[model samples]
Target: MDSGDVDFAHTDEAARKRRDKAVGLARYVWDRGIGGPELLALPDDRLRKLARAAGANPPSTRETWSVVAEMLDEKSRWAAVHPDDPRAVPAHADEKIMWVKPPLPPWPSR
Candidate 1:
């Protein structure tokens, strides 16, 4: 779908950056087969830091990461049905209607 096909408010730069980072982290861990209980057990601060490093707006509290997780799972399902439409994923958590491919940055190795 063309960018114009979706009608939604644009996300500000900072928020978009944050969302991108979060998505990247989620994608990275998922791609590495690192998730489920192990992921859920991560400390909120660690998750927040990872999200921040990934470019996502960090979750304000421990409970907030679940929102991103849910979004990721939903996007995965959506992609399964519409495999060709990767852009169907939302660009920001606050604006689910507006869609964009979540940026996937290279993981930072220590």
Candidate 2:
């Protein structure tokens, strides 16, 4: 079926089966430490092969890399500051600064 023509509806039994499958896949991945960057960096075809070997469908390599990059960025940011440093802590003191855009004057009429 075409992407737009695919049906999203599922019966109760089908939903339960899907949920069970997902849980099983999650357990398998967790046990194998599948979230690590080495696995995340594998090519899409290779990832698919790995996932099939693990009995789960693999997502696109781009999606996997995006997730890996986000996790690494977060970890790096956290590691940059000392735990006891007050200045290292993120503050909400200027949350409004991002939304405060400068006003522009009206354009002259032709």
Best by lDDT: 1
Q: Which stretches of candidate 2 lie over 4 Å from their true place?
A: 1-9, 36-47, 56-110
Q: What lDDT would each prediction earn against the true structure?
A: 0.54, 0.47
Task: Write out the backbone clash pairs for model 1.
Answer: 18-56, 18-57, 21-54, 21-55, 21-56
The residue-level lDDT of candidate 2 at 22 comes to: 48
Error of 1 at 100 (Å): 24
Off by over 4 Å in 1: 1-41, 86-110
Per-residue CA lDDT of model 1 for 1-110, tens digit only, reads 69768433334764575466556767644443333344566667666656665566665654445645665576567766986664544344443112222358999999
Say which candidate scores most in TM-score. Answer: 1
